[model samples]
Target: MALIEYRFDNLRHDRIGSRGIDLQSLDRRSMEQAIAELRALASQKDITFPRLPEAPVEPIIARAAADRKDFSDLLVIGIGGSSLGARALLSSCTPGNPGCRVHVLENVDAHEFERIWSGLDPERTCVNVISKSGGTVETMANFLTVRQRLLDRFGVQGVRDRVRVTTDPESGILRAFAQEEGLVTLDVPPGVGGRFSVLSAVGLYPLAMAGLDVEALLAGAAAARDAALAPEAESNPAICFAAHQVALHDAGTRGLVFMPYATRLFDTALWFVQLWAESLGKVRRHADGHTENVGPTPIAALGANDQHSQLQLFMEGPADKCVLLLDVEERRDLRVPAVPAVLAGLQHLEGQSLDDIRAAELRGVRAALTEAGRPNATLSLKDTGARSMGALLMFLQCATGLAGSLLGVSSYDQPGVELAKRFAHGLLGHSDHAHLRAAADRAGQGKALTSVH
Candidate 1:
């Protein structure tokens, strides 16, 4: 199994000066307690993600293989947690010659959806509709639109052969539709929510269809799960990371910049943004009936690229942010040719591989941030393989859960998101959500408005 290396030296005051975190002053007891709580949570039957790696994958693999044999393209329809995890996996693992072209219909934008839909050959396309609740508007809208197109082109039997659905096994409108249509289906596991469903059929099915190694991916996640369960906080990378983040948050750090050096892992950073923001950002109600808004803002950035774009603000902006740098030690490489004599000033880069320059840039940024007294840390992978990506994703998920515990928030629920969804449903004229629509209209009645032409 490939393991990720967690380095926190740059986050320490001794290394990054006064503005950095001081290990001696950290709340060790609170962190330990949080980890203990997370351990218990993991052992609970209702928290199913930690056990996802152990679920049987034979059925998923068989289905994917069949899809690969029959289809030239696979369209994954879903949004947010439903689509982000699969995007992260495919972006990072399905490079080179993918077995089938995988396109994702994650948004409800008509133009984007039309582009993807129009490009696909209906006869050779497989549609995978994924929604744990079977009720997400964006996901359902896109899937319904595509289903209509498939029905027009292939008829009912053809639609059944081409469509696959992953939803709640025991309930959900999508499940009922699948049964009514006799479409092949997979379960999203009883307790595994969308954000935590990657290791389950949600991710494995698509990955298998792409001819990637699902077993290796699960192995890496399992390894990460074991490491996160270590008895000592220092021995568990996830706990240690969560503890540092909590300490930083206590010190008024509000923004977390998740910058990954590799372009492929940029999607992984976005996936982390959702996991961290949705899982941690919450209104915590105390025993006294008072509520406080909690959780840090997660900023996703691509390194080397963001170094040119957002690095300036980070270096000199408010001391309200901490940087988490992601490094992939090995990558596909290209050597820079020797600089021409006329361009002698740029000779320093001559004969250096692109990866070498990227390493230098990462190191220089770390040093510069340290000199500026801005706290930062790095999480590194030996290579951008399936195992490494799995470990990276699991580590972030574990850290998010632990950090939520430390912050005294419910990690599994997103009440704020649901409130927004209710408003959207109301706006769309859903009878049950009419009250939410009225509330939204009332709130918007006298708000100032601005327009630009």
Candidate 2:
């Protein structure tokens, strides 16, 4: 059986009426061509992310074990791809585990820094500064602030002992600084971008410190990778999913709502948002030199809870969304108490397992969406274990790469985000970006049509 069970029945014309995808009418040749491109890319040395699951775990395990022996807490300093993958992995796998605790500082909020800093013992906390380029303003700011705190608490040598750096192996500011300071360092792999570096030292190191089975995580990812490389598109989940998404997007589905019913998997959905939005959303220049803006807007949502919060809009407000519902076959659950005489409306929930009730909610929502002529699909997992989470992450990443191919855009680059960063640097008075800063100021001088005080 597949690690994830993908059901597209509700996304079919027969199930969801006029708005659903017609399987027979899908452009199979284009999808097959995209899959072929993905296959070719996977074999290239420049694209290393697809091969990350097969990387050796011994070094990461050894380093993590050593760090865990000395530190009681880990303060991670990074943002975006540098931190999201680790955060998702730790959140999903290490909850309630009696292991070294992890505290991540991804934002520049002073209050958040203070809260995390005040809770740690500098002596027992190890600071991990991650940046593939080592030039991220937010990450550098947090790293500097935290580094000073460690220096204040402990001497220079002590700071060296407690701090680590993860960035490009040979270049970048962080790499140079680590070499000069003699601090422990790990590489983020040469060709792997930040978003796709999770299965590398970027994510594995922290997960290992958190007492998660990093090997098992890779094992699950490897299984998914093999399935992704299958020649038959029908048996390949990633290709099939990419084809479905491309077909739906072409059919006027502008929003992709990723709703996973499990709370542990919520961050996974958020991770998917960045992966999908950044990778596929692009302005592409065709062979004729004509450019066009493309890609779907990805919305991250939690289930059962969002049923009350966002379901109303998804059900009745918009006809431009295609929902991907994630359901986990939970291994542990609780049963509701017997019905009470005073509460009659709630009687049906009594004596039912919480998951059983959740299953009903999932089913009801799927039915309601279908009845209303909305397209949706379910990706069910066996459980939310380390293996399952690993498989899910890899599967989504592969699907995203294939989707980028279908859209005729480069999946790994984020030129829009880079442009914004440049503007921010200019606005912040960076010597190199002074021209940009002046332009930004000029743009800001324009008056608003209306305002309220």
**How displaced is residue 266 in candidate 1, in Å?**
0.5
lDDT of each: 0.86, 0.87
- By TM-score, the best candidate is 2
lDDT of 1 by residue, 307-388 (tens): 8899999999898889999888885569899798898689988888999889888998988988898989998898877887
Off by over 4 Å in 2: 94-98, 449-453
lDDT: which candidate is best? 2
TM-score result, candidate 2: 0.97
TM-score for each candidate, following the candidate numbering: 0.96, 0.97
Tell how far residue 343 is off in model 1, in angstroms.
1.7
